[model samples]
Target: MGREDFERMARAGFIERNGTVVGDYDPRLLELLRAMDLAADLPELWDLFDLMKAVPLLVVRGEHSRLFSRETVATMKARHAAMEAVEVGGQGHAPFLETAGLPEKILEFAQRFASSVRAEAPSS
Candidate 1:
């Protein structure tokens, strides 16, 4: 959403009252925006998955995200047969990790992967 829309939402109590909306331009944020703008033209590196074939991959996408589409997730799964994917419901663009149970999911995934690794490790 744009700044104006975000401000309107904040005024209407849609966003948290404690949160600060950038009512004025911040110079530091401008630098961040400039960097993001420059990074936008970078080429997609989906093929980099080839190097991560041995790594445990977990792909979490917002259910309504335009950036990470279902097709992309499907292709990721097809390319990395072991990749696990999950979509957080009722979120757009990016999921709110604090409210989306993402931390718990990540912990579960890490624990499961760690267990598998331990099981496969040779006993000294």
Candidate 2:
């Protein structure tokens, strides 16, 4: 984004700036954006259940996010019975990871997953 845009976002509380320089756009990032636009129509994404069945899946979503709707989240939970989900209050599109309580919640989830794995492992 341009300097003006960044300044406006900072003023509006969308982001916090710590005197960091932020103007130049990366050519590689532009290329990746183009590639993502070209690959937007991904029908096979619905078949992720087969690949993710054995893995611990966590879906942390912003409550007001426009990209991932509530219906989609429900469908995902229906497809993957073991999926864990959490909604960050009063956030849209994306939640700032540095928000209070977010780190503690993630740590708790990780610890629970590790304990489950240890319990399932066969004794030597």
Off by over 4 Å in 2: 1-20, 23-27, 36-40
In model 1, state the lDDT of residue 24. 43
Q: What TM-score does model 1 achieve against the real structure? A: 0.65
Report backbone clashes per prediction: 0, 0
lDDT of each residue in 52-80, candidate 2, tens digit only: 97788888888889998889889888888
Which tens-of-lDDT digit does each residue in 63-91 have in candidate 1?
Answer: 98998899989988988999999898876
Highest TM-score: give the candidate number: 2
- The whole-model C-alpha lDDT of candidate 1 against the native structure comes to 0.78
- Superposed Cα RMSD, model 2: 5.8
As a whole number from 0 to 100, the lDDT of residue 27 in candidate 1 is 57
Models 1 onward score TM values of: 0.65, 0.70
